[model samples]
Target: MNSEFTIAIHSLALLAYRPDHMATSDMIAHNVCTHPARVRKVMAMLRKNGYVAAKEGTGGGFILKCDPEQVTLAEMYRLTSMGSVKPGWCSGDAEQDCMIACNMATVMDQLYAGAEKQMIDYFGQWTIRDVLEQVRREQEKKPGV
Candidate 1:
């Protein structure tokens, strides 16, 4: 997985925590430790998908448009990634004729598919609310938190 998945989750969690407040992309980028443009891109995608609502100009930003508990991590993953998720392997034409390379590629492809399936299933089991609870619990366990 790439940063988009984590960023989307973090962005949504921030919105979920501040349900009544609007969060700018800059604020979200600060929290996610990424570029504001990336956050804006993700936020735009989320907004287009009806997961968030955006407002322009002063005192305007983004807010969650749907219930956190109703949105699964898998949904966020799919939305932010836009269904372009792929295996972490590169296959060139030169290696296609090699029996060993061909076999390994096939095996790796299957493994990747299995791994992705498990990950999607795991994501399906948790919502943004559960993630927030986990974060709060961890923070409370910290020495100064």
Candidate 2:
């Protein structure tokens, strides 16, 4: 899968972790270890989808709009990375004379689609709050945390 999905989920989870549930793009980028522009790009998508809201000017940033428990990873995936698990280049050419080479692309496409659906369905069972809680649980097991 593309990094956008992870970025989106991480961004949301980070927001949920905050007591205020609000953070600037720079803050999120630091937490997620990415560029602010990337965070802004993904946050814009989330904002457009009504998962989060943006506030301008000083001391303003993104505010969580949806209930964390109600926002599933599946929704994030669909919003940021649906149909993205598949590779763009499959090892086949339809014009090739060999049967395997000619059809491998189509077969891989269908297989990837099925796999993505299964993954999304599995993600549907977990919400943003779950992710935040899981991270907290994982951190509790570590000394540095």
Candidate 3:
């Protein structure tokens, strides 16, 4: 999987952790180890989808517009990235018709579709709050806070 989902979820979880404050793209990029621009791109998509609201000026940044408990991972996944799970087979030459090349694409398409559906269904089962809670619980079990 690409880093978009991880970035999106991590960014959201960070916001969820501090629902009262705004999260800047720079701060999010630092946490996710990506460029600020990438975070901005994802945040723009989230904002467009009504998941976040952007603020301008001095203390300006972004804040969650939707309830953490109501926001599902599946929703963010669909919003932030393209759904293609893997690359499909493609023949190098158009005239070089091969049975394997022709059949592989169809086979891969079905497999990818099934896998994508299962992933989306699994993500649909959890909300942002669930993920944040899980992370907090895991952190609590560590040697130190």
Candidate 4:
């Protein structure tokens, strides 16, 4: 749910479209309309998560570590959004035994848990290849003005 998650997904989806060629950070940034540094930062995270591999010389860039069909959005979300959950109605104290605390905090916690489960389940159903196909279909459907 952060920019990193979105950017990483975008980068992977782009790579999925062209699996045979490595994509440079600059090229990915151009598609993202952002700076190459930003792309590299996200790429580093993806690399750490074993989703991408990078090369270190001229004519080198990034490539998928595995097949796009093997990468699920749930895995990407877990990698990019680790330790990023926070309850909306609770203070810094995530665990308090007060009666009032139990009411609102419990409801909020359950809501967040449910939301996370829904997100994971939804994303787990699709792979990067599915996203690329959807993007391609959408692009093909645009009418000329």
Q: Which ten residues in a row have the lowest lDDT in candidate 2?
A: 13-22
Return the top candidate by TM-score: 2
Provide the overall lDDT of each model, using Cα atoms, as 2-decimal numbers: 0.86, 0.90, 0.84, 0.84
Alpha-carbon lDDT of model 1: 0.86
Q: List the residue pairs that clash in candidate 2.
A: none
TM-scores, all models, native as reference: 0.85, 0.90, 0.88, 0.84
Per-residue lDDT tens digits for candidate 1, residues 1-145, read 6778899899999999999999999999999999999999888989989999999999999999999998999898777653344555546333577777667766666666777788788899999999999999999999987
Which residue pairs show collisions in model 4? none
Ranking by TM-score: 2, 3, 1, 4
Question: Across residues 1-145, which tens digit of lDDT does each residue of candidate 2 receive?
Answer: 7788999899888878774756999999998899999999999999999988898989899988889999999998898888888877779999999999999999999999999999999999999999999999998999977
Our model 2 lands, by Cα RMSD against the true structure, at 1.7
For candidate 3, lDDT tens digit of each residue in 20-81?
Answer: 99988998899889999999998898888888899988899999888999999988777754
Best by lDDT: 2
| Residue-pair clashes per candidate | 0, 0, 0, 0
Writing each residue's lDDT as its tens digit, candidate 4 over 42-79 gives: 99988887888999799999998868888888888888
Q: How many backbone overlaps does candidate 1 show?
A: 0
Tell how far residue 98 is off in model 4, in angstroms: 6.5
Model 1 regions more than 4 Å off: 82-88, 91-98
How much is the lDDT of residue 24 in candidate 2? 93
TM-score of 1: 0.85
